[model samples]
Target: MTFTPTLSLYVARGFLLTTLLMLCALTGLVALFDFIELLRRAASRPSVGFDIPATIAALRLPFVAMQILPFAILLGGITAFWRLTRSSELIVARAAGVSAWGFLTGPGLVALLLGAIAVTGVSPLSSAMLARAERMDQSFLRTGGGMSSLAGGRLWLRQADRELDENGVAIVAGRPTAARPADPRDGFARFELKDVTVWRLSAGDSPLARIEAPRAQLTPGTWVLEEAVSFGADRMPTRPQRIELPTELTPGRIEDSFASPETLGFWSLPGFIEVLEQAGFSAVRHRIQFHSLLATPILALAMALLAAGFSMRHNRRGGVAQMIAGGVAAGFALFVVDRISAEFGEAGSLPVILAAWVPTVAGLLLALSLLLHLEDG
Candidate 1:
């Protein structure tokens, strides 16, 4: 490589390394604070284990790195450009027939490569780890492992009897937890509930029969309600009775309720969207997230362009201090625009793809305009 290309490559590599180091340091400090808080909360809870705190800390690093990437890119690019100007390396390259655009190619290529890695590789890993971390947090924090969508927590279904077309059953209970208990035939697939109430619905949806119980456990195809009270269809109170509920709901089905589409990676978003539609839930947020992931590279490139446009002027024309100030101002302005666009996108006022990409495109255009003015003028 020529001196210009070599210098640009060196500067770009240095910037990448510096940005990654700064991001890791800042994220590590924040993670330490978060871990301390998590540990304190775990200490307060009697049954909660220390494993959750460790898991949370482990998951936070990747998330923080993702969040800080744009800022790091901007700052690192500015630092590199500032150093080149200070050393008069850019001037030397220009004297040797290197155009401003020519010098930028190396760093731009680096940005593109980094952006690709972030979207395809880092994002999936982060999403998976974050999902696991969320589950751990919930299990350690909530009761009954939280409610599932399809089954487990007080399921109510109306079934018709053979003789009369009456309402079937209304089930309510405390502690309707789902777990895979040991079963002979099915091996291991069941949903169990404790402290259950089953109400048989009569004509006009009136409660015809009510069964109160201390425990009800669901097996592969059956629910066993124990220590229950039975009421007659005549709306009269009967003596205590126990019964079995015939149903197909299982623990896996219940767990599916808590599995959100956002927990999936970018690669899984399309399939997840199909599943969401089949399940009757909207996938708007997931679609937006996927688009945002695709836009990450463009956003990083825009930040670098903005930094260079604002900071990489010749010192003879503008002092180094002024250039640095201008760069900082430009970065902050871009950040504000990005935030506004994100809010608009989130509120559905703007198209998701447009909102995610507009700021980046705007920044790149602005930078190109400035570069043309500086170089050709």
Candidate 2:
């Protein structure tokens, strides 16, 4: 009954195990459902083999697990605390003058630590896999990638072409500028750009030509630019009524290249945000995502507190179910609020900091209030 280090470690160990179990269960179930959904989508495309959907679903699991982590913490905390109470371990601890907060400190810290690890370690892998999954989904499952991004009323895309030199050395033009290495599997597709500017580069990154157009539309395999003008290093600018350029970009690929903030790793976000803003695109969503990730540890602590509030008590008839239901409802309420505030922040209706931290703050306050009421009253 003593609140010794061994006792606290035991409690924390139990909580971590349960949380890991819950995460695995939830992630596996979700992945199974996702695989089925992908299979259904693949049904229409006879050429898409079974492996395509399976691979995509597997690649998507990490992102899904990230999204489900908070829920796993809530459920796991509830189970762990409920077990302690049901087994009279917490009851004996209370009889020994150890308050609820004393034992909960271990699990709360564990949750907080796990959240930090997820944000810093797991996020990068999840983002990369999510990006790859999106590309696969676009290429294999869908006819088009998706709607192209018009961030801050501008879009930036880079295209590359390769040629063999006389000595058989390969030269690349318009090299990729993304943080990650370009995937060799991506194929060329038609693309359209607005307020488009094309830079033609040669070996050693030397500029060859520059083309600017107000509007460009995709044809079968080319971009047709209207009111086009060209500039070269040694020649004066020439305006053309219309110009055609070959491309290997599709709307979907363009959208994939300009990935959403969620698909960029946490460490990569700041740089990508800077790139977006420098390219005349809004970084509001990326800013919101970054701040939200920073808030995850606090959010995890709140969930643990809330779970302890509901589940750490003397067992009463029919009370366990009620506490479980209430904890679940409260957890989901926090999630809904977080999503809503995020949307508001992205829409500029709320400050990014406020939107990102409000849910965590509110959850912590509410959980603390509940714990105080149960403990002191």
Tens digits of per-residue lDDT, candidate 1, 137-176, equal 7778554545643354444433332122333444344465
What local distance difference test score does each model get?
A: 0.70, 0.78
Q: Pick the candidate with the highest lDDT.
A: 2
Give the clashing pairs for model 2: 145-252, 189-248, 189-249
Q: What's the C-alpha lDDT at position 302 in model 2?
A: 92
Candidate 1: residue pairs that collide: none
Candidate 2 C-alpha lDDT tens digits along 298-363: 998998889888887666655878888999999999999999999999899999999999999999
